[model samples]
Target: MSDLSRLSLNQATIKYAGMEQAVSACLRAEIPGIGLWREPVAEYGLRKTGALLRQAGLTPTSMCRGGFFTSPDSDQRIKDLADNRAAVDECAELGVPELVLVSGGLPDGSRDVDGARSMVLDSLAELAPYAGERGVRLAIEPLHPMFCSDRCVVATLGQALDLASRFPAEQVGVVVDTYHIWWDPTVYQAIERAEGRISAFQVCDWITPLPAGVLLGRGMMGDGCIELRRMREAVDKAGYTGPIEVEIFNQEIWDADAMEIAELTAARYVEHVL
Candidate 1:
C-alpha cells in the first residue's frame, strides 16, 4: 500500500496567492497534485494556467467545483449547466482526472432537499456523458450536513456512492473529504462500500463553536477533532489508492505566505495521517 505521504495541495488553502504564485509554491515544495478554482483561472486565463502548470510539472488533481444543481428557476439551472460545461472544458485542457461536484442545496423559496438532490442527479446524468467523452471523471463531493441548506445537499458517503452507482465506475466517482464527512455515523461502512468509486480523498479538520453566519472556517489537520488517521484507513480499506489532497479553507491560512502554508499543510497531513 502507498503511504499517505503523497498529499496534494488544494489552492483554497492559500486563496490569497495568484495562479502563477500558487503553482510556483507547489512546485517549490515538490507537491504533485493541485486543485484549481474557476475565479483564478478566469483571472489568469485558462491557456496560460495550463501552460504554466505543465512547465512546472504539476498535475491538476481536480477542478475546484462544477456542481450547483439547486436553483429554483429553469433559467438559473440552464446557466449553471453552461458554467459546468465550461469547467469541464477546463479540466480537459488541464488533463485533470476529476471534476469535483458539490451538488447544490435547496432551491430558492423551497425546502425540498430531496427535490434538489433529484435535480443534481438529473444534471449529472446529462453532464457525465459529455465529461466522459472528454476523459474527465465527475466526482461527487458530499458536503457536511451543516451545508445541507445552501451549499450541498448530498451529505454522506453512502449518499454519494449511491449517486455514483447510477453511472459507470469510470464515468463518476466521489471525493471523501474528512472535514465534511467525519461526523457521519456510517462513514466507515460507507467507505468500505465506496470500493473503487472514491476518486479523490480530501483532508481538513472541522472547528466547532462556529460564529454565526460563518460558512467557511476549516482548521488544519490535528487542530480540530477529526481523526485523520482513521479517515485515511477507511479510504485505503475501500481500495482508493489516490493521493490524499489537503483542502483547508481557513482565513488565517490564507493570510500567510503561500509556500509556508503549503509546506505546513503537507507536514501536518503527513504527521497526522501516516
Candidate 2:
C-alpha cells in the first residue's frame, strides 16, 4: 500500500458524519489528516473538536471556507468582512494555518462577472492582512466555471493566482482541486506558477450526467475522467508537500457509512492519486 501519511479526508467527503464520527473514521483508516468545515465544527463546539482531533492524532490540514465576498449590499458586505475575520480567528485558535476561500458568485442578478471577481480581490486585500497577523493563510479555491453564477466567481486557478499575487505568499495562497481544475488547458502552467503559494491539494473526479442539483456532482477519485495522479505530481512539483485531501461531494457516497467512505477514499487515493 502507498504511504497514507499525507492523505487527508476532507470532512465533506463523508458529509453526513458528525465531527466525532469524522474523526473516528479518520483514525480507523489510519489517515493522518482531515480538512474541516466551519459549520460542523461550530455545531460540535471547537474545543471539543480540537480535543478529539488531538486525541486521534489527526491534523487539520485545512479549514473549509471563509468567503462569500461578492455581496452588493453594504450592510451584508460589512457582515461578510467581519465573518471572514472571525474565520481567521477560528483558524488561528484551532492551529490550522490554511483557511480555504470560495469566493461568492455574482450578487443576485448581476451579469458583471468582472465586477464579482474584482470584489473577490478587494475582499482578499482586506482579509489577507488579518489572516497573516494570526498566522493563518487564505487559500483561494477556484471552482469550475459552471458554479460561477451561484457558487464561486473565481473559476480558474489562473484567476485565483492573479488575486493571490497581489499579496505576500504568507498571507494569501491558492488551492489545487482536481475535480474543479482538471478541465483547464493551462492548469499545469498555473500549478507551476503557484509554487510557494499552493496551500492545499484536494482530490475528486468529474463524471458526466451531473445530478440535477449540480453541487453534489463531484465523483470519488478514479471513478471519473480527472487525471488525479498527474495533478498530484504537479502540485508536488510546485513545492506543495502538504496534505492531499479527498473531497468528494456525491450524495451516494455520503449516504454510505462514514467509515466505509473513509476507507474507500484512502484506497482510491493510493490507487489513483498516489
Candidate 3:
C-alpha cells in the first residue's frame, strides 16, 4: 500500500456524513489529507471544523471551491468577488494551502463563451492579489465540457493552464481531476506545462452515457473506465507530489457510511494507482 496516508477524501464523497463524523472516518482510515466544502464548513462552523481536523491530525489539501466569476449582473459579480474574498479568509483561517476555483458559466441570456471566459480572467486578476496576501493560492479547476454552459466556464486543462499563466505562480494554478478533464486530448501536455503551478490534483472515475442535467454522477475508482494510475503518473511527472483527493459525488456513494467510503477509496488507490 505505498503509504495510503497521502490519500485525501474530499467530504463530498460522503455527503451523508456529518462534518465531524467525516473527520472521524478520515482519521480512522489514516488518510492524511481532506478537502472541505464551503457549505459544510459554514454548517459546522469553520473554527470548529478546523479544530476537528487538527484533532484528527488531518490537513486540508484544498478547500472545495471559491470561484464563480462569471455573471451577467454587475451586482452578482461584486457578490461573487465578496464571496471569494470570504472564501480566501476561510482557507487562511483553516491554514489550508489552496482554494479550488470553479470559474462559473456564461451570464444569463448570453451565449458568448469568449466573453464569459474573459469575465473569469478579469475576476481572477482582481481576486488573486487578495488570496495571495492571505497566503492562499487559487487553484483554477477546469470542469468537463459537459458543464460548460451552466456549471463552469473553464472546461479544459489547456485553458486552465492558459489562465494560470496570467498570474504569479504563487497566486494562481491548475487542479487536475480525471473525472472532469480526462477526455481532453492535450491533457498530458497541459500537465507538463502546469509544472510547479499544479496546485491540486483530484480523482474520481468517469461514467459514460451520462443523463441530461446530471450534476453529480462521479464514479468511484476502479468502478469506471478512468485510468487513474496514468493520471497519477502524469501528475507526478508534472512535479506535483500532492495528495490524490478522491471527490466522488455519486448518489450511491453519498448515501453509504462515511468510513466505508473512505476505506474503500484509500484501498483502491493503494491497489490500483499507488
Q: Compute each candidate's TM-score over C-alphas.
A: 0.95, 0.98, 0.97
| RMSD from true fold, candidate 2 | 0.8
Name the runs in model 1 displaced over 4 angstroms. 1-5
lDDT of 2 by residue, 37-130 (tens): 9999999998888888888889999998899999999899999999999888988888998999999999888999999998888889888988
Candidate 3: tens digits of C-alpha lDDT, residues 150-256: 87989999999899999999999899988988888889888888899998888888776664537677888887888889989989998888878989878878888
Q: What is the C-alpha RMSD of each candidate to the true structure, in Å?
A: 1.9, 0.8, 1.2
Best by lDDT: 2
Candidates ranked by lDDT: 2, 3, 1
Best by TM-score: 2
Poorest 10 consecutive residues by lDDT, candidate 2: 48-57
Greater lDDT among 1 and 3 belongs to 3
Candidates' C-alpha lDDT: 0.86, 0.92, 0.88
> Which ranges in model 2 have alpha carbons more than 4 Å from their true place?
none
Better of 1 and 2 by lDDT: 2
Candidate 2, position 25, lDDT: 96
Q: Rank the candidates by TM-score, best first.
A: 2, 3, 1
